[model samples]
Target chain A: MATKLARRRSKAAAFGVFNPNHVVGGRVAGLIVAFWTAIALLLWIASPWKTLPTPPEVIHALHDLWWNDGLGPELFTTLKLIFHATLITTVLALGLAYLTVVPAMRPLVQAASKLRFLGITGLVFPLTLLTGGGYALKVALLTFGMASFFVTSMAETVLEIPRSEFDHMRVLGASELLIVWEVVVRGTLDRALEVLRQNVAIGWSMITMVEGISRAEGGIGALILNENKHFRLEDVYALLLVILLVGLGIDALVGLLRAVLCPHARLGKVRR
Target chain B: MIPGASVGEVVLDVKEVGLTLEEHLILDGVTFQVKDRIREGITTGQVVALLGPSGVGKTRLLRIIAGLDAPDSGTVRGLQGEELPAGTVGVVFQDYPLLRHRTVESNLLLAGSIGGLSAARSEARTQELLKTFGMEDRAGFYPGQLSGGQKQRVAIAQQLVVPRRFLLLDEPFSGLDPAALEDVSKLICEVANLDEFNTVMIVTHDIRAAMAVSDTLYMLGRASKNGKHVPGAKIVGEYDLVDRGLAWQKGIMERPDFVALEHELRGLFRTL
Candidate 1:
């Protein structure tokens, strides 16, 4: 009797009508339906003149802009800026976090934590003096903007590491550099990636502001300014969609990277 | 080096080590030495216990010995030098801080790689230690999945996966039931018996557990005098468990000599 019931369930599953495991729970499915429905209704209401960009029109504009209007290079430039800024921020944050572990350098870390309230946008003109308003200025702005938060998060991550792990590494006669690599880096890589993921979004959000202020050529921010100047609302929507899609893509890539780098996290073994 | 060194010979001399943190002394003028021992032509390592009450600097002293912490005024010399050679000391921390990012097998493999062992040798040794610790079935399990006793066993086995002349176990008997404690004690004795670990120091508050597997015992304590707080830990007592050979045999805890030693250690703690 049990064998017959199991066979029936398998047959039902094969037909796609009675899957024992649903793709989403009932509540989640309902929420997703409600969310998309609300979006559709909002789009309809906002398109009284039927110019709020249908999906096909947006896709067509995206294709035309990406292929002919230099959108690809501008997009790449913005991404490159974010990428380099995140890299520099990570290295600086890690160095700062390492220093905080030293008793003598703890005061420095406390000072850095307090500087988080200083706005990077406010530093635009001051930093332009140090770096003559090009890639360096923009990169510097983003890195400085994100650095304090990254350092604080990374330092907390470092502290959350059980001291015993560091002791264990030292007992193995590991050199200072080796301990940094084997214990600190490996122990905190998962959370560090998380910090980067969160900080990169903030960096991206500020990218357009910096680029617009600098009037940088060949960037999404410049492109947005150009579109806004011409009153091409459809093209503006298309560019906004491009930015949204790119941000979501980066997020997905980071999630995949995290999964590969820290499989233990997927197993729910990470303490936080 | 010794004039004519035997196998498993390691000499440790800790001289007048002092450390102060934030105006509170943790270890002041602490000194001890472990001489090489030869028993019937077999060079046996000395398993010593750093016993003290809670809040004393037993773990701090162990950290100093492991080269994890710097002493304010003294030096720890092993193998007749200022420093212990790489991969000569392996520590099992009080919390058994196994790598959360790796499984049991991967943790051992990581230690092996850090010690610069060849991959084949590391793989072979990891398997051997896993089997020895009765964790053959748990090689793929993460540390978070293990019970307290299993985590302790894996922690010890992870260290043994690499070659080391000294093994330091901090509070190995903590959070164990009576049966688990006995089992872990036997495991420690077996590891200390191996020729690789020429010196073993266990920092523990459980006097009976410490006495069970250690061949020598040292006590650290803090005392107040003249209405002033005494800074740092001081060596209070030393006992040679080697002189009581029969106490090391099975059911030694039930024996009168073991009971008497326990009472004496308790009395010593009371005085502190």
Candidate 2:
């Protein structure tokens, strides 16, 4: 019995330490560190400067831009556009999805599906002619480019909620509208948020395209376009880095919200 | 709890109900009566177990009674000839079908709101149910965080958030551990006995669970003679619990009378 106990103990020791609680946290930290290191290496190699901007130099550049160039307002404008676009997409997508399930409104949903193939960039001429430059044009471009996918993806998410859930709500005395609110909306909210996070990058790309064409007074896209025209390679690279950082930050914030709202989703290994 | 409805009376009747799917008859002239049973102001709620083998149309029969699927002929009524109000019959589906994104407490609140309860009433009922099902600690947890037993309890509790005329549990004991099965059966007994619940019908193949908690037993099986394909299956036997006073008591299965009754129930199934 003693030999058996010793053998078991040795086997456990050989297998290595196991801290089940911290495994997920440790792995996530390692991944983040590795990712940042790879980005820094790429930036260092690509820089034309004799002395590449080290981590400190990049941090200083971020600080310099924020204070001297009205970068704060530009960043805020870009963020505001993306935020509203996501909000509009969420509401409109959910509404379209709700209507799709209704027999009377199903044809309207079918008609909306055709928008999936409608190209936003191709509509630039008419959009500029109708809405014209500045905020309206930007929003219209972003909405037109992204709303169709959002609506279809959200509708599919809503549809995929098992029919049994709808039946459960009905038997519990819920009306058709009530089922739409409870079973359909609450059921799809987290998934819809995830889809928005995935599609926001596409929205960002569209924002850049629109800004480049129309020359907005402010926004990161305008900053990038201005930097590009002057051939300020360092400034352009720095602005791109800023864009990448801000995008990641926003995605992380949305992920945090998802963690809070749907705690069981366990979306990330990193501990809150 | 709905106005104009009386407690301690027959609330649901499935009379000569026939259902067919794609030319395959599922329930043929299936009939059952559920009376609200109360003792000393505590509903001893009548648990009528619908015992049947797989593919014997138990689920289809349940759907018909819940009014989710229309029967080809005959009638299913609540409060005599009056149609059941929207929330009269709450069904706990076999898989629980919980809103995965919402916390346990919010799920109950959602159900209450859909049932037209006031905000204050919904909040009160949500807390009450969370406590009743021994899930107060898990109120903040989402469905994905729960064990099978906890999910099952929440599913049933959400249905009861609004006082229902009848509660239908589909295969409630399918995947429970022995201890969990015991706990769930006890909960069913306790909840059914509440004045708010008139009748609780459980569909299960687990005779032990049925024998432990149900006051009435119903067995359903295919009746094709000599291995022929029967078009439909019907109720085979019904047993009253009045004679077996100790059936609900723990370890009742070890009792001679309980064992004898279990044998008798198995005998009916064997003949099918």
Best by lDDT: 1
- Tens-place lDDT digits, model 1, residues B90-144: 7888788877888999989988887788999999999999989999999999887
lDDT of 2 by residue, A1-272 (tens): 99999999767644433444433346656766898999978888686875445555666777778898888999888888878877777677668877777879867776775687978767878888898667777777787677788777777787688888888777777788867877777667677678777777678767677667666457889888887788765667688888888888878888888767756566323563
How does candidate 2 score on lDDT? 0.77
Error of 2 at B219 (Å): 2.2
Q: Candidate 1: deviation at residue B217, Å? A: 3.6
True contacts kept of each: 0.69, 0.85
Give the Cα error of residue B191 in candidate 2, in Å.
Answer: 3.0
lDDT of 1: 0.80
DockQ each: 0.42, 0.52
lDDT by residue (tens digit), candidate 1, A77-108: 89998899989998998889877667798888
Scored against the true structure, residue B189 in model 2 reaches a CA lDDT of: 77
- Model 2, span B38-148: residue lDDT tens: 455334666788998777899988888887888898888886667754467889999998877678898899888877899999999999888888899999887888888
* Clash list (residue pairs), candidate 1: none
